[model samples]
Target chain A: MTGDGKFNIASEKHGESTVLRPEGDVDMSRSSTLRSALREALGDKPSRLVVDLAKVEYMDSSGLATLVEAARNARTQKVPLVLCGLTTKVRAVFEIARLHQFFEIADTASAAIEG
Target chain B: MADTKPHVYLELRSDPVYLSGARQLIASVAQRLGFDEMACSQIALAVDEALCNIIRHGYDRATDRPIWLSVWPGRKDGQDPGMLVVIEDEARQIDPTIIRGRELDDVRPGGLGVHIIKEVMDEVEYEAREPAGMRLTLYKRLVQKDDSQDADQAGASPAGSADQGRVSNDG
Candidate 1:
């Protein structure tokens, strides 16, 4: 699904983990796409989920809620979900909303994947 | 079709419904113009926040006066593609100085409008119009076709081009 004009999810079977790269504005409008991507990344079983937000220009409460929900779901299943490469503006939304404790945020995708 | 003037205006009664409808009008105008996705989203959010503030604070929602809204596609420079969003309300005059942005940490319901407007637009100004009312003028310069098209070509970018967006919740 296309929303907010920019989002990409490419699945790679790296033996265990899957990565989802999200770009563009993530607001109420783009939450569905984000949820779908997260679901697809997790699949039926459990695995490491890495969501990269290096190119995200904007995000709102709805977007933050989506991430919080995804993180909770991953926790229930004992799967590792890491968010990487967040832009300052997007980070500010999460920070201002006091939602930083929701997910494992890594400084870089490589670090998230390696860890 | 009638040869009507391009400008559109609406009077917002000191009612919740009127404020909401005014917000929708801004969204509709931005949508109809084929505005870049980010610009439309920004305006919609800003308009919603603005209208809520007007109804909740400016008009007191219990007053008899009406709020007024004017929407038109305008540019400061003839060569530039831009938009002018004007919201006028026949409520008590507001102190422009009081319009100072509130801290995000306040987390209160009343002040988010200022921050939303600041974030959404490149320029925003509030004024106390004569005859006892308030006027808010918002300006946004559209990232037109050529520049946005180029951004789309380069890589994953902000609402520069590919104007058609995927998912947007009305809220």
Candidate 2:
């Protein structure tokens, strides 16, 4: 992900892990892009998915809601999903929504992918 | 009508895609006004909420009227980049009495827009324009804090007067 709000997905299959970097404002307008990327990363029945948000410059409530919904969906499917590298601003959003406790949060991609 | 104009002016249709474009413009112009990223982000949030109200309830997805959004950046009262955002739309005439902000304990998915808008702006004003329409004016200090202190210390109101708010009939 970059400050320009463009994120990339670099998947690795070392043992069991998927990484997707999302940049830009993931509001109602660009939420579909994130959802599409997650769908591709999840692929089969259920797999562990790790999202990196270091490059995200802006994220509104709609964007936060999408991530929360995705987390719920992954849980229902028994797939482990983790979000890593959240900026302070992004982290504050999760706190405001009280969603920080609902999913696994990590400081780095390695932590999420390896955990 | 305030004769002064914003450094940048844009009119957006009542569409979701245009919301993102409006936010992007706010960020770019806000930054140039010497506003920190957080202050700019707060303004963007306020703008989004205002637009949301116009989309869902105001127009009801039935009418084809355009929303007029004007962003003003100036050094009023010697404060750097004091911004005034005026949003005028011919959507729905909202009654202030029924538009009370939802509480945090209420916890609804859709009704928080007004709450967020009021909380983020330094000063908020609403008026009924001539003919048939509404005008929502939001003012914010780019650098300095208002009399009530900072955003974190802003108080929520049962009647929505705990903060600097004004509603008038600008006939």
Candidate 3:
């Protein structure tokens, strides 16, 4: 995990897919860190990008917006983006904004990569 | 008995770094008022969104401006017990009527904060403050076991249509 004080991003490469696990509350103060990590991961041109959110207990709209931007970028680059392991609170934010309709979600990172 | 109306007051600069602190305060208050875990999370998220809007738009990304937050337990007089959060900002004031979340079909990075705030809170009110600023009041009522269905349905309103709050110019 690449640590930036309270927030950290653990990135791994699984064959052609890259999984980014962000730990800590993904709020406005820490979203830019996640955004930078996603940009770097996407820049590597992985065939599939999976974000694991099992450890994220809280996420504000800024974090959601960051992911939305990354989703758009991934789509434009033809990199399949999958989000997995969303906690109940994080999932509610997506559902509230009606963004659940826009992204591909999976129960786990392994499921995302294999399926 | 008179309503004590105990409340917590916080004053901070308009900086994103302080968002989490504000969220924690509101969430703790909501939980203390008997909101479930999910409801507490929702309340915190709504308050975070409101503060974000103030810092990003109202303060125009200036982090040094003043933002005041007041949180208290909801009134119990014929009303469901919950939590109430009022955020006051000394920044640029605009037409309260025009503050709204964007269309969901647009599919963009920004503009989702307002929608999240409206969706999570049971009541939202925006009024222009005197001189120059805005006051945003958000309320979330604790739901009884049998009333969960009604609360769910109320929060399930369509995105853009969730702008049912009162907006007035008091400046």
Which candidate ranks first by lDDT, i.e. highest? 3
| Model 3 residue pairs with clashes | none
lDDT of 2 by residue, B52-116 (tens): 67776788854356888887765323344467788888865767556655665543344556666
**lDDT agreement of model 1 with the native:** 0.64
Candidate 2, residue A64: how far the Cα is off, in Å = 1.3
Candidate 3 per-residue lDDT over residues B1-171, each given as its tens digit: 245444788999988888888888877776666766667777788888888888888888899999988876675243546677888998888888998878988988888888888877878889999877999988776555566566456774432223222111220
* Cα lDDT listed for each candidate: 0.64, 0.67, 0.81
| Model 3 ranges off by over 4 Å | B1-6, B75-80, B146-171
lDDT for position B114 in model 3 = 84
TM accuracy, model 1: 0.52
* Interface RMSD per candidate (angstroms): 7.6, 5.8, 3.2
Segments in model 1 whose C-alpha atoms lie over 4 Å from true places: A1-115, B1-6, B76-79, B106-110, B149-171
Ten-residue stretch with the least lDDT total in model 2 chain B: B162-171
TM-score of 2: 0.71
Q: Give the alpha carbon lDDT tens digit for every residue of A41-104 in model 2.
A: 6765435788888877767666665676677678777888899998876775555455567669
User: What does the lDDT read for residue A11 in candidate 2?
Assistant: 49
